[model samples]
Target: MSIPTQPTDPAATIPAVGRINWRAARAMLISEGRLLARNPGVVLWTVVLPVAAAIILGSIPAVRRPSAGLGGLSFFQLYQPILVFFAITLLAMQALPDVLTRYREMGVLKRLRTTPVSPTLLLFAQLTLILSVAIVCMALMVVIPPLGGAPWPRNPGGFVITYLLGAWAMLGLGMVIASLFHNAKVAAGFGSFLFFVMQFFAGLWWQRPNMPVWLRDISDYTPSGAAVQGLTDSSIGHWPRALHLIVLAVWGAATSRLAIRFFSWE
Candidate 1:
């Protein structure tokens, strides 16, 4: 009788190594950054509106005043986090999957097998560059608003923590999309759909404070929702709820695992 065998692991081809090639990694980063700068259209459009909106809103005295409708939270306070998450969500859901699928189709990933550099380095570089753009945008939104007289985030540490976790979860979702889809069109469509869903939960359509109690409860479990709420709390001088942080961590971990398990070079 023939012996049965287990299927090969997705990451088995890339053997474990004790060390990373930092020089190669640095070169990849520079190359990727140059490409990103060359194609600035997407980044420009995706981030400009939210950043401008945040600054405009913050500068206005009307939006800065607490409103009864938002449970005494000023409009700027409510929307700042939403805007921050919006930019990153767009990058993660659209830019990330789009680039990965294109690379796979062009055989860049497959060709890397013949090169000294690991294909994984390219993936890491893309993630770092994209996340770095999102972070820069985040910093601008936060710093500029206060200069315009809007309130600053009271718990800076909590704000930073929530943002990092949220970005991790969103980026992992992007990697998962790339790992699953072979066609660029298919990946873009799926990413676009996910982008809208994330925005809805992040309060792009409806402010989190204004959502119905039962509906808000439902949003709490989603990465976008949890992250937004946590950011809101941090902005208002409260530490993020344990539950929200836990939800973000779970989303990050689960999506990252799935991406690694299913990801392919081509």
Candidate 2:
């Protein structure tokens, strides 16, 4: 007589990312890019207006002149950072959450669990695509202004750092929106609400420098307020305030934690 060995389930052996699988991640990223290219309705709308606004503002000599009402900064200078952030806010709040919620609704994330490709890989792919789009949009806003004689940011390094941190924070918040709302329509409505709030703090309708001291102090702690101010400081040849950097970092960390905690593949 021979002893019999129990059969192992092959499905159980496929791990959910013990280590980062770069190859699978890349393939998924490519796949995501294709899907985005096929249906790019919201992203284009979110990105184009801000880029055009930046370029147009930079081109206008009047807007570049120092304005006493704007606290001695040119209108373009004050608005540039706000406009830059606007594109990012829309992409993160509206575009990112919409896609993610839809993926969950369609059972994409749940199906990926059985494959060698983990859902984490899919998330990395989505994030990469969204970030790439944001960066390209940012670059257009930054580069195209000079052709019309707008000045580049005085502290390029500082500006880039702050912008990147700000993007991370916003994207993380977007992830949280996806995690909370399974219904795509509900997620979209919430995202729109968030977008408007961010713009309000970014000085879309009211300039930060013009806000009352108490209100401005409150705004300083929010991601949009801190990021816009940081970008403004860098553009004016000053380093970003440590307070703003800390605020942005904290928001990024907290939002990412919440998203990961609550997000469900099913």
Candidate 3:
């Protein structure tokens, strides 16, 4: 007797299992982008708050006064970098981690693993959205400073380099946090705590130039602190100090490697 063979499904054969599914990835990216656009918290943190803070600070007469310590730049001019750093911190620490952990909690990443489209594509989409928001916020920051008569960066190229490096370091740290935390609530809480501490070191609450020598020394090593210092240096026409760039590069490389190694699909 001959054995009966099961028929293969033509639909299944059309989408090869091991191939990259750009169509699926693109669809997922569009969906995630729409969700992100509708998130009130993301809008508040990444867009509205940064711009509002810059405008408010720029409006202050005292802050507009040129400071001898700031290389004759006004307090508002010096604050431009801090506001940009704040936007980066908000997205990288608070927003990115929360989203990734939520996906894990919802089993979204696990489900995606069964398809030809890798779950990593979703992560890339989210990062792209966050980076776009950050760029807009940074541009707003640069524009607002000039509105208050604050001078633009003297070394624009150096400023761009510092900004990109700082963003890479912070985003890498966020990825690490997301990879480690399974619970969305815990991830968000920890991210917020990190955000505040980094902002403190970045001099959002106090002027870096006025900080005690030891404290300033310590802050310079922190990612946010290094970013602020690098941006400030570049704003005045100097290349960021080798030390600051090194710190940022080290953090970016180390945290990114750790995140990739530890990341879980579910």
Query: Per-residue CA lDDT of candidate 3, range 1-266, in tens?
Result: 98877558768647565676778778888999889868757656566877788878877788878889865867876787898889988899988999999999999999998876789999999888888888888888877767766677888888989999999999999999999899999998999899999999998887788888899999999999999999988887899999999999998999999999999998
**Model 2 error, position 235 (Å):** 0.1
What's model 2's lDDT at 144?
91
Residue-level lDDT of model 2, residues 27-107, one tens digit each, is 899999999999988888999899999999999999998899999999999999999999989999999999999999999
User: How high is the CA lDDT of each candidate model?
Assistant: 0.93, 0.93, 0.87
Q: Record all residue pairs in model 2 with backbone atoms less than 3 Å apart, i.e. clashing.
A: none
Show the colliding residue pairs in model 3.
none
Q: Tens digit of lDDT per residue, candidate 1, span 169-260?
A: 99999999999998999999999999999999888888888899988998999999999999999999999999999999999999999999
Error of 3 at 63 (Å): 2.5
- Whose TM-score is higher: candidate 2's or candidate 3's? 2
Judge candidate 1 at residue 167 and give its lDDT. Answer: 98
TM-score of each: 0.92, 0.94, 0.88
Kindly provide the TM-score of model 1 when superposed on the true structure, using C-alpha atoms: 0.92
Q: List candidate 3 segments past 4 Å from native.
A: 1-20, 59-62, 69-73
lDDT of 2 at 112: 95
